[model samples]
Target: MKGRTFKHAMAAHCESGTLTALLNHAGLKISEPMVFGISGGIFFGYFESKKFPFPTFVVRSRPGQIRTALARRIGVKFAERRFRNPADGEKELDRLLSLQIPAACQTDFFYMNYLPGHVRVHINVHFVVVVEKRGEAYIISDCYSPELASLNRDSLMKARFAGGSFAPKGFLFYPVSVPEAIDFRKAVWKGIRSASFYMVKLPMPFLGVKGIRMFAQKVVDWPRLARDTEHLSHEIMKINIFLEDQGTGGAGFRFMYATFLREASELLNDRDLLEMSKRIMEIGDRWREISLFAARIGKRRDLGPDRLRELSGLIHERADAEEIFFKELLAMSKKKK
Candidate 1:
């Protein structure tokens, strides 16, 4: 029963048993891939800052008997998942010792929410660790669930101030009352609240539900849609054209349009949509062929715009019709669900 309020948390660092000073001490010995974070939501930063490139490893630390409660209800993705299993807890604990304090490490910070109860604080912290092989930065990313995101009725944009202040509930900590490491985490996540992961740095089209899971959902249903082959012909043709029309630099309006629609397609299930989807597939196939041809002709530079316009014409011509069709498809999908 350590104090549960932020005011009590102010003197948190005074506890030498906490992870903050431990991480600071660890930093004195620069080393390789490692992790040092609380269990309840403070992110670790090694390779890059949150706003830049690098990945965040979410850690859930515990030094208590009731740690059994965490065996399953809590889970995560990314290298952070390295800590997911029951067997690796001791190993992760050791690795934490070897980790160096991220260059940006701060003695102060803030965050949100909390998991109540117990002897040792049960909190989760997010960390930014770089993937390097033989000493070179490899990849960067963020771990978040859309389901978790959708729970936000607040529609909070990832803001500079978003995770900045120590949350009203104070920082998320690992395994209860056991000297909380909540201070540093609250300080850190707040620092990088508006930052995007490395994957986001690339000039990607950023289509909806930006994740492999979301992408997979669209991909999985594709096979089911394939059974309607004949109806797919024109549909595919239109789709290819639309994809190309997505615009000039392979960025902006058309890119967003095509990417967004591909995701939007997932929301519908109308006969017309199925019909249109079939055409979209056609165009997707044809575009590959056309792109190949353009490469051969050295006319690829013009290919993008030409294709975008040709494809856009279909949707443009049947704008209202397609909207109604897709809306019906959406309604249909809801009914099926």
Candidate 2:
């Protein structure tokens, strides 16, 4: 394997970062937030998964959706394939590399040696780019890693084939063709409209702003649902870590979305969206406060149901603010149209 002149940059989220690098390599020169927002990647979902010991909270759409949306919106032709055999997947990736194309693949972080031991988990939706192969090792650019790292072929295969939810199955994707020009305005409008629709029009109670409210209600009842103080503390810690420590760009992806909104505002010359962007940043701050409070509760282990209820009330306020904000955004977009 020879050196390829691909520019590798760090980013906040994996999928968005991978897309940003891929598009830049293809001469698009877009930022991560632009890729994220224009792909309608921001949203919320909360549910109890039997596969896990606790509930699940997600701040963005499921994996692969952002890549698909970004490709379609910007008129980039791409191909994604999942393999049943790991050897075949390796051959396919090598083929792409031979043609000077960087390939992005989904893998489990637990097998990535660059991550801290504590942070390594069996998360299979993590995405990374393979830029070059040096004999037995593959040079990878993982967004979450502090710097680029190399993994031996055996290690890369293990990460790609890790068994669990959202299993990678050696999935690989790359843009086949890119347009010379993109309809930025149309893409931005379509992206914003889709996000607004999901936030304001989604009927599921465990999605959008409604999901926040529902989760807050559940938080209020944690004492009654848990068997003891230890159980309640564990649950609080889990929620706090998921919101504050996960690769959400801080505050459960609210900060990232705020940045995207600010960028979109300038691109579209819409001051209203700019104001909303500031408001969303404030919301992200509020979310950080909630996480801090949860951490405190987890450590002290003395917060009663009434105290928990107060925290739940704060979350309710956040939900109310988000609900109003999304509705206003949708109305503003419609008026502009």
Candidate 3:
């Protein structure tokens, strides 16, 4: 197979984007927003562990759940594999590419040399599709990249085998089949319900809307945890990057989910959903404000307690808004049932 044969397109989030591309390549047309929404991809979680460099938070569901939940809901079959040895993984990927198949791979972002240096963090859950091989390089379609990119064999291997939290372990997957017909209406509602349930119903304090609250409460203590003022500023500015520029489709996926809701409303012809979609868009705007505020304060080196307290207040407000939003969404799900 020749390199660059697979069509490359950028998307909001890597996991859902890869799934959308695979499904489309298999002749099952679907939008990224639909895939994301139906997969229950929006979520929040706060973490402070010794393994991590500093306190952090997540704005989406656990890695790989999007594909798993999507397959179950939409009757798609994907062939998945994980390798204990990097050489074996490379051989398998080559075999697939030789057959003109595009395979999605899990890799640590730090080793994707195609990315800009500033964004090359050690996130292990980044997804990209290897389309073909040319000499010693693999042509890849990364949702984060605006166009097709190439990674050498050594860098690819290192990325696939990178150790730490959420290691890829040389994982790869491809869509084997998709059903001829699908019940999108049912799938949308189920997805919304699942997202709502995970957000509002999760018992853990550090997950879901509760997790947002924890983030709000803990952010005020970030100065104490940082190595210095500059460190605190960097972490604070990361809030903006995580929410907007990190392929979240803006506002930590609130905007994308709003798009999903609007699309679902049109498909289901439900006025209530249309209204809720508008509401969520407004909520996303508020989140954008928070991101901007964090960026501004951090860039200005305004790490005083008073500024952090103000930031905490903004997060707390978002938490309250999300709690109400998810609860109402859960109620709406019941009515749909």
Best by lDDT: 3
lDDT of 1: 0.24
Best by TM-score: 3
Writing each residue's lDDT as its tens digit, candidate 3 over 1-337 gives: 1233567899999999999988888888899999999999999999999988998999999999999999999999999999998889999999999988999999999999999999998999999999889999999899999999999999999999999889899999998888989999889989999999999999999999999999999999999899999999999999999999998999999999999999999999999899999988998999999999999999999889999999999999999999999999999998895
Each model's lDDT: 0.24, 0.85, 0.93
Candidate 1 structure, TM-score to reference: 0.21
- Native-referenced Cα lDDT, model 2: 0.85
Residue 268 accuracy (lDDT) in model 3: 93
For model 3, name the residue pairs that clash: none
Model 1 Cα displacement at 333 (Å)?
Answer: 1.7
Q: Is candidate 1 or candidate 3 better by TM-score?
A: 3
Model 1 Cα shift for residue 89 (angstroms): 24
Question: How does model 2 score by TM-score?
Answer: 0.94
lDDT order, best first, reads 3, 2, 1
The C-alpha TM-scores of every prediction are 0.21, 0.94, 0.98
lDDT winner, 2 or 3: 3
